[model samples]
Target: MNDKINLNYLESYAHSFTEKVCSEYFGTKKYMSGQEIIQLSPSTQVNLMVIKTLFEKWNEELEMLKANPYFDYKDMAVTEALKEFMNVLSRAIKIEKQHFIPLLEVALIDTVLLAIDPLVYFWGEIEKNPSPFHHLKASKKYIKWHEKLFSELISKGDHADEEAYKKTLSEIYHQHENQLSSPHILLQDLNKVLPLDWDQLIPKEEILTETAPIMQEPAQENPVFFEEEETPELPQETAAPAEPVDYRTSDQGEIDAPKPSLGNGKSIDPALAWARFEAEQGGLLKGPIESLEEGIAINQRFMFTKKLFDGNPDLMNHAFKSIDECDSFVEAVELINERYTSRLEWELDSEEVNEFLHLVYRKFDEK
Candidate 1:
């Protein structure tokens, strides 16, 4: 509530978090104050706005997790919490364009707190101490215990330099792989664990100092050298072709055409965006669909879907019709492709628009 109290709580939470991780990774019992934690690297420029924003978001998610019906879902709740923390850390870093370094460090600290430490601290107290207030009160012993259910509730949910954060952390962890331990070792093997991008986040000097030859293995083991395995083609099923319409004729039924919305601002039509997304992803429907569901859930959480659902009711119905009627996921996507190809009107074909459409469609799927 009060400024001083909030600041103290923030620092204390961070301190406990950092201390646990540092103790595990560096094998040091040193108590790092929150300020010291923030100052781990001389290059990092701390931003209070970024730090406060991170804490507020984490706290909100933690509260939601604490209220989960643990019995019904079994360990689903626990695993969801860990995954949620991972998502938060990755996203916090990915989104913070300005204070990236500081945010990345702080978020890593929180990730270790929520994802790793909780399996030890919170799970022990969770059954006995069900209330979020009670769990939070035990902060020193169990940092953010409530975060165990963080990923379970309705949520929203990466890549490229867009993933500069993970790349930065992987580099840091790999550079110090020998010096660090346990989870730090695990974090360093990021490519094996999860994919990330952006090599420009860290200073060259720091990266150079730890230039001990990183152990390399066979092609399969080394992600950098591992060639992308070509996707196996699915057995094609022929369907009766729909009546043809010349997409180049006009912008009338053409959803792919770029048009100014009600306002003068040029916006890609949502209908067209969905089409291009399916087109680009091609047969890769599983990953995109999962992402789409997550984005839709987030939109629902933020109340962004209500107005769209209220207005374009039929459009929404038609979209889901593809989902329900199509034989397979790829078929579902093919339906989208067919819909767009029939009405396509864009002058130039841009892969960039396809990429952007893939991103936007995931955020709002038709019900």
Candidate 2:
């Protein structure tokens, strides 16, 4: 009658379709009651995280039953529960994991059916007895299922609510947005039975031409597919080599600006600009730098000593008095790291700290 009924209908449809498909193909027997597929109550809002967690739990249970034959596969109740559980998990896997962890081509067909519309493939009459289960389904079967569902649910005398029907279809589309391989086809099929303007719901750019009906071809000894023709290549151009521009160093023997400057007279050297920015930002580091004052002092002395001997370990002498005092780069880093850590509280050994250090080093590497 409303959104609630519409939502419930989809939930029921998914469950019923899942159970029917399982029974028809997976050697499962029909049972009176099946496990819940979509666990969300009518009032609960659907969330991706919640759905993912539910799917993970459902998958774990399904796998447990499937891996051990000790769990009776023949019991109608067990079989039905397994099918419904798999249906729920399969939907979730399709929605989230298909792109990441894909199945083999042979298995993906039934898996997609269990997710999209299991009822039509499982219950409706088709050309093949076993239906191949991998090929495109006959268009007639799709049309028949559509008409049957519409007549029974949407077009019935008192139950016929056009708005509810549209809302339900919209919800179905939204839910399966990621999972359905061809939502356009489903919309086209639905348009055949309903009087509603289905094209309006689909943007013109996405609307596909009517797919040709699957032809019933006789089996051949050696079926061949036509190879695609390759386009001719364009002629190559020979170009003069260009000189490389130095990004790190300027003619003034200072770091260059990270960004290119416009032809304004107020252009600034990048290294000096970066140092000024760091010093200005240092004011925010008072609290954190105070906490790591010892580590900073030790690191600073190490850098200062290293600079005095030109990075030569054998020339190190803490007692040498002739070395001139210049501002240490690590001091600037200590301030930057402290400021960042005050807000985010990252460890000194963390990947973020390592990356930040490398970025700072690269800024000074031009010299």
Report the number of the highest-lDDT candidate: 1
Q: Which numbered prediction scores highest in TM-score against the true structure? A: 1
What does the lDDT come to for candidate 2? 0.29
Q: Which residue runs of candidate 2 sit more than 4 Å off their true CA positions?
A: 1-59, 64-188, 192-196, 204-206, 214-367
* TM-score, cand. 1 vs. native: 0.24
Tens digits of lDDT, candidate 1, 1-367: 0000111222334444434434453454233323433343311212222333354466568668767866443478866766566444633332322233344446543443232222222222222233433222323221222221221110100112212222232333233333322332223433332321212111121222333333221121111110112222223222222211101111112223442221112323444445544554221112334433332321121121123233232454455544455444345445544563334432223432232234334434443
- In terms of lDDT, model 1 sits at 0.32
Give RMSD (Å) of candidate 1 vs. truth: 22.9
Instruction: Tell me the deviation in Å of residue 54 in model 2.
Output: 13
TM-score per candidate, in order?
Answer: 0.24, 0.17
RMSD in angstroms, all models?
22.9, 25.4
